[model samples]
Target: MPSSNKNLSVSVIIPVHNGGESFRRCLSSIAAAVPPPHEVIVVADGDTDGSWCVAQEYYTTVLRIPVCSGPAQARNLGARTATGDILFFVDADVTIYPDTIRQVAIAFSCEPEVAAMIGSYDDAPGAKNFLSQYKNLLHHYVHQTACEEASTFWGACGAIRREVFFAVGGFDNRYRRPTIEDIELGYRLKQAGYTIKLCKSLQVKHLKHWGVISLLRADFFYRALPWTELILRDRQPLNDLNLQLLSRLSVISIFALLGAAIASLWWTALLGGVVVFSGVLLVLNAPVYSFFVRQRGWWFALRVIPWHWLYYFYCGLAYAIGTSRHYWRQKKQLAFGN
Candidate 1:
């Protein structure tokens, strides 16, 4: 394997909708990197905000879709036009570190056999608000602790060999919204025997701000529900990312606490069971909570508990709903013989 990335070429592909100031910073970061990308392809997917025009100012090859298409399509279009050894997919809202692309090129150049790799969000998020910090930090913790041999791909900061990407059909365009498109692509890549690495060292800064309603909507609809259906369809276990073993247990504990609360009304003894389940939850997730405390102090960690518990509660509910829908669709398909 070559020691340096001098011979390698990378094409950075960014898919944006209505990219605002954050997108500007992302482009600026690209400009500031030690070694610039071989080419920059920015796909503006039905942007009225003139993000496409801004992309032109940066000397990027800007492509536009008149009607709004999801990131999957946008990325695929960008990939089709790319002419580099590696296709580096970066989300528009994410800003890369000065050495981010260098790290990506190094990963590919040094590990000749690895076909893909993903990076995590930096511990220090761009947004300083409490919820944004907690959410982005949780993401950082998960990716940092996950197996180096990645089980899934993340579009926020991920790269793949160009030939291998097209050979596997790229991101599944059926996913109209941003739902598990990247994860599904990762699964397919693994099925085809391609290796993907979780390069924790190559971190990027997430520029998204989190609000209660937006966060919950994304978790329940865009993530949990679609994810549950995917697992059922593909016979995959809840064994990776946010749906890992510990998260499954946490979801169970949350629902059990709710059940105990309801039962306490009937017998009054189950009230103790509520406390027991809650304690079990706290113990089960002690590592993450401790992580929060270590990173943000006791007051912040304490404040995060109820929100974290609320996360589990909604996860459980979404799983229930997703499972029911999956079975119902299957039943209907069987009844109406095709």
Candidate 2:
């Protein structure tokens, strides 16, 4: 339980823009949660969707950024205006569960060395579709387990001491694009020798609205751009198993196309190989899919599988393109002054 003292306060910063039903749900959940924030700061970024008015109904501390400054900027602005010792930055679409704030407070109290703590999101229960399942699996692989050498924390439901946040100069506004701001900020914090802990008790319910086209666009912007940035900064070759799969896929695709133009027998052999490779990818992802199906049932799984494969293909392609572009741009910039 949080102490009744007003001095030990927490400010929840929610950045919003055109968030429809999700925004309302997000706010309600926060309000419902135990140990409510001392103040809920909602940064409305040029929202023409009446999201600001909706927020006004619930929160008194609202800042409307004149233009659409993106989430990182909005979050920074909120942080600057927050009066709390701890800043809880959450997305407008997430619905945090009860006891989340209490858990975060307890974690910090227990571990004085921990600079920050991140919570888990409730992956949609009936989200059996391929893309949804893959996304959930990917998230689980990266975060569900604790890290002894903790580096990055998810931005969705993360808390940081005001002093630590200022020390790192907040998030880099240069990453104004869709989804990498969190990862980039986390990277910077790690570089500055701050410990980020993943707390299982602090949970948020994430409502993913993923379709085929949405998944593709997400791959291009979210997954691809950040990955490319990481590769550029780290200067490490893509040695992950996912990258290896993409390489194998690309090779098979090349041979299959070449054989089609040359001989019928070779074409048949290449086609068979491609089918086998596709089957292997599906099989590799089956355990995760099965888990989703068991949780959500078969109907959701059928819809999610194809979407997942499409996401995988596009994500791989986007990463390849983004990384190439980053390298080319860097080389060009170095060669030319402007």
Candidate 2 residue-wise lDDT, 73-171, digit = tens: 999999999988789999887788788777766666667788887876665522555665556555553355445335665678889988899999997
TM-score of predicted structure 2? 0.81
Worst 10 residues of 1 by lDDT: 1-10
Q: Which regions in candidate 2 have their CA more than 4 angstroms from the true location?
A: 1-8, 125-142, 145-150, 236-266
Estimated TM-score for each candidate: 0.97, 0.81
In candidate 1, position 82 carries an lDDT of 98
Most accurate candidate by lDDT: 1
Where does candidate 1 stray beyond 4 Å? 1-6
Per-residue lDDT tens digits of candidate 1, residues 204-316?
A: 99999999998999989999898888878888784667877998999999999999999999989999999999999999999999999999999999988999999999988
lDDT of 2 at 123: 58
